[model samples]
Target: MDHVILFEGIPMSKSMRGMCKEEDYAFLGEKGKHHKETDTLGEDWKEEKMERERRRRERAQQEQERIRELEESRKEKEQQWRHHVSELASTQEQRLRDRLARIHHFRDFQRKVLVEEMSLQTDSESSQALDQLLTRI
Candidate 1:
């Protein structure tokens, strides 16, 4: 007696060239038994997959746009801060130069006063010497 296998109501003999059609065969086990097909996903599985992929892409795009905006804002803020710091440095340098100029002016005034005092003392000593010489004569 010849043994026969039936899959999806189709009879398959041992010596048959093509035992089962590709679409009708679900999964072939080690024992050569074909597993029955089941509904792993509902009828709306394709639509659900499409919707999920669309939402994911949208979220990724939004995140990228937000990062770009943040970078631009950060660059602008950094430029403004640099400008502010430069202005402060320039103002401080100008103030320092003005202070140094004032110190120089005060030093020049003190030197002029010392020279005048020395000249007056020398003139008075010479006049006293001339008077003593005249009295001796």
Candidate 2:
């Protein structure tokens, strides 16, 4: 680069020497110009393009992973809720059965007491009638 010459204050090609010949160049500092990959300014544009593309692909992959995690979490919560609802239903059913059993027991006890009271009343009325009959005789 330091050995490059200038023609009329315009930057020119390198001098014909060990690395190149005068017939090998078409313009100053240029090979036969049909867009070679090596002649980009500052940095290689292909590498930059590839880097941006890679970043886009990585972001897409990460987004898919996040969606999958959210889906799994939603399913897990739904399953837990279903189990909780089942437990509540079972508990309600048990309570209803117990209440019905208590009502049946109370009805049986009431019927037995009523039967005993009726029997005692019948015996007392018979004794009173017999005493009156004996006194008259």
Candidate 3:
């Protein structure tokens, strides 16, 4: 008979029956506007989600870089400490060697003095013995 059928919110039956009025076109345009609004809302939600993910990734990357810098700094400090310790050890070793050499030199000087004193005592004894023997003759 003359029934009106809606196709995507637009009347398609009666062959240009209800669609001939400007009011009908305006009403159908409102339906399309609602669809566009829904599509834009979904797009905005997706964009916001993507932006949040990007910011999170950037923060994670910055944290990783900071950790790497800290590790490198620790390694550098450790290396410097080792170098400083080695230098101190070397200095101490040299000081110990010098002290030992001084002790040895003092001991040698004392031995030489003792040898000279013994020789002087023996020479005096020999001279007194000859004098006694000459007086008796």
On TM-score, the leading prediction is 3
Lowest summed lDDT across 10 adjacent residues in model 3 is found at 1-10
Screening candidate 1 with a backbone cut-off below 3 angstroms (N, C-alpha, C), the clashing residue pairs are: none
How accurate locally, in lDDT, is each candidate?
A: 0.65, 0.65, 0.71
User: Could you list the CA RMSD of all candidates, in the order they appear?
Assistant: 12.0, 13.2, 13.4
> Model 2 — which ten-residue stretch has the worst lDDT?
1-10
Q: What is the per-residue lDDT of model 2 for residues 1-137, given as tens digits with 9 covering 90 to 100?
A: 31144222344455524356433443655533434644573257777888999999999999999999999999999999999999999999999999999977865565455446544354666546544543464
Candidate 1 stretches with Cα past 4 Å from truth are 1-11, 15-43, 115-137
The reply for model 3, stretches above 4 Å from the true place, is 1-33, 117-137
lDDT of 1 by residue, 1-137 (tens): 01123343455575562755543443332223321223335436777888999999999999999999999999999999999999999999999999999988965665456546545354666546544543464
TM-score of each: 0.53, 0.54, 0.59
Of the candidates shown, which would achieve the greatest lDDT relative to the real structure? 3
Predicted candidate 3, C-alpha RMSD: 13.4
Sort by lDDT, best first: what order? 3, 2, 1
Question: What order do candidates take by TM-score, descending?
Answer: 3, 2, 1
Question: By lDDT, is 1 or 3 better?
Answer: 3
